[model samples]
Target chain A: MKKIESVKNPLVKRIKRLQKRKQREKEGLFVIEGFHLVEEALRHDVEVQAIIAEDNKNIPSNHSGAGISLVTEQVMKEMSSTETPQGILAVCSLPRQEKPLSIKERGSYLFIDGVQDPGNLGTMIRTADAVGTSAVILGEGTVDPYNDKVIRATQGSLFHLPVIKGDIEKWIEACQTKNIPVFGTSLNEGTTHTAIEAQNGFALIVGNEGAGVQEKWLEQTDQNIYVPIYGNAESLNVSVAAGILLYHLKLFH
Target chain B: MKKIESVKNPLVKRIKRLQKRKQREKEGLFVIEGFHLVEEALRHDVEVQAIIAEDNKNIPSNHSGAGISLVTEQVMKEMSSTETPQGILAVCSLPRQEKPLSIKERGSYLFIDGVQDPGNLGTMIRTADAVGTSAVILGEGTVDPYNDKVIRATQGSLFHLPVIKGDIEKWIEACQTKNIPVFGTSLNEGTTHTAIEAQNGFALIVGNEGAGVQEKWLEQTDQNIYVPIYGNAESLNVSVAAGILLYHLKLFH
Candidate 1:
């Protein structure tokens, strides 16, 4: 056990730095706040570097293996990104996310292209988990899955699935090699989403909040489908659209 | 058009007060920040009380009817809830939210019970609007749709639909009399959502993120259905689940 009472401790500063994407990538580590998220990280085989607690009381009695550090309340608050510090947090190695060299035969996957909102990305990851997609591939300009807001919105499901960043072209190529059809949302052309028959496997691409699928990617999709807007709203939230589409395609299997 | 430079102006204080629920309720008004939101409020026919802009440049030249106030950048910053003021804001009359005494004939509706997250509530409202539901009834304990975060998350869909607050019991009873089936999500009991037939008119009730549909309400549902978890995630985000369910019914119609 280590006691870290000073707010200015070098270790506390280092832990606080993980809140930024650049620091997290540089250290190859990220911070998970609260008991539930930390526990999920441990349970999912993520390598926890340390458990930082405001006091020993905040640490679960069953917790073991990781070095425990007792920090002052002020120190914990300083390191926390949330307004109210949850009293306990764990520093864990980032998940080993790799672009798939090849896709599984007859397997469904989600390809997220340039979805920027952290909350939207998180919700989409959680939905992707619910549908049991083989994986989630993030295209360039997409929000990082490990971002704190995204992680919180995921509700611990980030640990339940594999989310990796890759080029859209490579992902499309990989899926096509496996004979998995690629689909995207396009209002101006192609079949309506509902009109398409449920398939055994496919790759679904969802794009930015402001922009639909990028033109280059849209051109390559084996099919482009649009959800009919039956009301005055111009479009559905990207994540909501993805959830509806992913489940529709996956449920039949 | 009126020009004001002081943050201490009486009218400026009133607009700032609209951020709080009690004040908003008493005044029957709410604050919407940003150019797009203000524009949407006008386009949707939401009664705009005033348009406040950081400078004359942010205001459209075609503006008429409502009083427009030009304020200094500092004053606008003080009145805006967002970190970066979008330079334009509007004070609008709150929508007439009330309990429904009768249900519409053969029209789809969404019933939200106790969802507390402003973002989730807002996203659900946007999804409900996209599906063209007749109305969205927010049960007791749900977050105020007028809350700033909720309003922002809704994009502009908050103006596109009727979102009313009411008792869950009354809503269920009204639906029953109109021969509309009330469906709920239950993990342990109920048919899988995919197995259930889509209907032209019905009420879909989604409960609190943590507690799920109250046991009492679950007992009253004409049918309970669950979205099967194909992965290790215990559940999907509530709004995501609602999105999947709402589109399922809407698509079939």
Candidate 2:
């Protein structure tokens, strides 16, 4: 096992770079911190590039298969993004996005279009996983799933399902070709979700925090559906809306 | 209209104190920031104590009924909790908690037990409002809904609903006496939610983020229900779970 004692170490500096989107993109890797997330990465078979643990923190030296490097407190602090680092972190390779082949015949999917809030994106992914959605497709302009806030909010569910980023307009069109109903949410007008027949195969699209699903994408969907707001609340948070819709439309029996 | 130019002004000092729970409770007031939330306070008819906006900011001068106070940029910054103050804030009296004379004979309700995250509490309140749940009762250990993070997360839904804090055990017993079925969520053992019969009036109790419902609360419920996790994820976020359960058990027809 290698021991690192200085924050000035080149390896420590490189790990710190994973905090930024551009650096993550250039290196094709992202950082997962804390004991639970690191444990999740190994359990889910995510490619682990390296594990850095505080020298005296008592985090496992080997997470089943990945070797850990022991680093001094100062060194670990420099590499950590959080104010209070949880003693361990791992640099994992970003999962490759799947090329659109065809929509599955009996699969449930969630398409997020331009959801800017990292926490909202993460919660939605967790909801999508809990309901056994086939995958979560992030449209253009959505927050990065691997961002620290998103990953933290997911509570390790990020590794439980395939979350891919791609062109949402194309994905909706692909679903239509396969006879999979694509449902978009709209505030102005749409069939109340309860009126829509539940089906095993479908895709539900939720939009931005403010301006909802882009007009271009709404026009491409098979139909728009809404969770009727019975109270004075203007709208539900995007993630909460996703949970209600996915379970009602796809999972409830 | 009073114009406050110095951060040292006594009224300005009192307004800033509302950010703290003790101060808020003593004054019986909470602070709301930004145009949207301030407007919501007015729309919902919550009692307004004061309005502080940037001296030159073009916020509605009268806000229909309440008077506005112009403050210098530095004073506005000092009064605002967020990094980017929206150039406006309002101090409003906290909504009074209902006396809990008894549970509504035939009303849908959500009981939160020890949910610690401020954002989670806020999101759940928003969801409750969307589904028209009669009231949300926060258990003794739950996060304060007036915390800036929670208030921000609610996105003004706080003004749209009755959010009361009280004793969880007594509330559940009260519901039971009125024949309002109480449902508790658990991971270990329970009937699947989809299998439970949907009814018009019921109370759903969601527990802490890490710990599920307390054993005592779980034992008292009419039934314990679990949202069947169909994927590898262990469970949904507390707020997301609340959204799914509330809609399915209360709103879905």
Task: Report, for every candidate in turn, its global Cα lDDT versus the true structure.
Answer: 0.86, 0.86
Worst 10 residues of 2 chain A by lDDT: A55-64
Interface RMSD of each: 0.9, 0.9
What would you estimate as the lDDT of candidate 1?
Answer: 0.86
Grade the docking of candidate 1.
Answer: high
Clash pairs for candidate 1: none
**If candidate 2 were superposed on the true structure by all CA atoms, what would the RMSD be?**
2.4
lDDT of each residue in B1-253, candidate 2, tens digit only: 5678888988778887888999988878899899889878887788887777885455644476566789877888888888888888888887665555457767888999999989999999988998889889988889899999999998888888778888888888888988999999998478988887767799999999999799999999999998888887888898888888888887454
Kindly report the fnat of each predicted structure, to 2 decimals.
Answer: 0.85, 0.88
What tens-digit string does per-residue lDDT give for candidate 1 at A115-169?
A: 9999999989988888888888899999988899999988888898778888889
- What DockQ does each listed candidate score? 0.82, 0.79
| Model 1 per-residue lDDT tens digits across residues B170-224 | 8898899889999988764798888777787989999998999998999999999
Error of 2 at A53 (Å): 1.1
Which segments of model 1 are wrong by more than 4 Å?
A1-3, A57-64, A96-100, A251-253, B60-63, B96-100, B251-253
- Poorest stretch of ten by lDDT in candidate 1 chain A: A94-103
lDDT tens readout by residue for model 2, A1-253 = 6679988889888988888899999999999999999888888889887788885356654465566789977888888888889888988998765656557888888999999999999999988888889889989899999899999988898998878888887888888888899999988567888788778799999999999998888888889988888887888999988988888888454
- Model 2's alpha-carbon lDDT is 0.86
